[model samples]
Target: MPLAALVLLLLTGTLVPINRKFRETPGGIPVFVASNGLHTDVVVPTQDARTGLDWRPLLTASGQPARPAAYPFVAFGWGNAGFYRSSRGGHTPGVGTTLRAALPSPTLLHVSWCAGPPQPGTRVAALRISAAQYEALAATIRASFQADSVGRFVPAVMLGYTAQDHFFEARGRYHVLRTCNDWTNRILRRAGLRAALKAPLAGSVLYQVQHVPKTRNH
Candidate 1:
């Protein structure tokens, strides 16, 4: 089974759907790539198909009454701290912000909880991976966060951009030349899946996984 994780690249709104063979595996659990035109996130089940991992502990709201399992999927992405935090409330960063993000800035891990399975289209695609592969991918995502002595992920002081998303401190620097897609591609390759050799744009990642057959879970 698996648990999941992402980065923001404020590039163009191009969505490429090229068929890539190294993107998925047959008869494996389903994961998804969710995009908002410019940036992309890797979405996974709250608890994997085998129930081998319960992500609730990591994403639990400290004082909320609702359980973490309420979310069907969790989309993870990474981005510059300023770009992520300031880009909230439908606000676009200014040239100053973009320039700062272009530098070696602190990073944050973005997590969005989905109510259901993602619908595949130009903006979304399914990628099937074996249980072992799922675990490896999840492990890389989990490692991005800064855990507390209590062992839970430490969320930013600010509220999520929306009701269903939150930002947490992460362990990378966001370079203007390196898009979030590069980070995700590394995760895919780490899991023994095929990914673009150079994924510096959101389209680079989406293009590779677009043709993967939709799994039953999707």
Candidate 2:
């Protein structure tokens, strides 16, 4: 029965949308969804004051000093910590770790400081959503971070990293049925954007975002 359910999920997860409504935002806030072939990340402008996210603590918690100009945007990605951390530093995790991550396991939030927006033809989708939509997306991202009693982001020290990015403890568990792309899709949906209902692959999310009309009148 479990195998049958898993097959059903994988089959239904790839179903394409039909007659999906694509709305336009009047001078909406620009955001980007990027994919590195395997995983996806949502990038938002750091200078957006309305987000109410203090970069100081995030930067300090990252344990990597960064300049404002050097990182105009912050990219957030969520996934299983075991697979995510092992994939870092050109190290591949063992099959046991991968299997555990593919099942139910602890998750982590990966943050990367970006200099500019995602490049063209690089599996990146850009969207201009309303301020309300952006606010919802930002709130969803912020809520993913696990905070201490004082409300500071709690860093996950089990992972080793050499890049400007950092990882923090995140809410929920990661599994094959509910992967990082699903989290990204959920966030986009929260912002009133069209996305796959259950996208476990990065390509699935990008495919749905590509269907949006480039230009639409209010």
lDDT of 1 by residue, 1-218 (tens): 12221233223212322224454556677788778877778888888756387676667743422445567788899877887767877888788988887678888888888888799888887777878889998999999888878667878776777778777878878885566777776677677765665677777777766645544443
Deviation of model 2 at 111, angstroms: 0.3
- Residue-level lDDT of model 2, residues 1-218, one tens digit each, is 59998777755765665325856575676788899888899998876765565465565654545556677788899998888878877777789887887778899998887878887565999888777888888889888989888777888885436565778889989988789998998888777787876688898888888777887642
As for candidate 2, its clashing pairs are none
Candidate 2 C-alpha error for residue 174, in Å: 0.9
lDDT for each of the candidates?
0.72, 0.78
In model 1, what are the clashing residue pairs, if there are any? 5-76, 6-76, 6-77, 6-78, 7-77, 7-78
- TM-scores, one per candidate: 0.82, 0.87
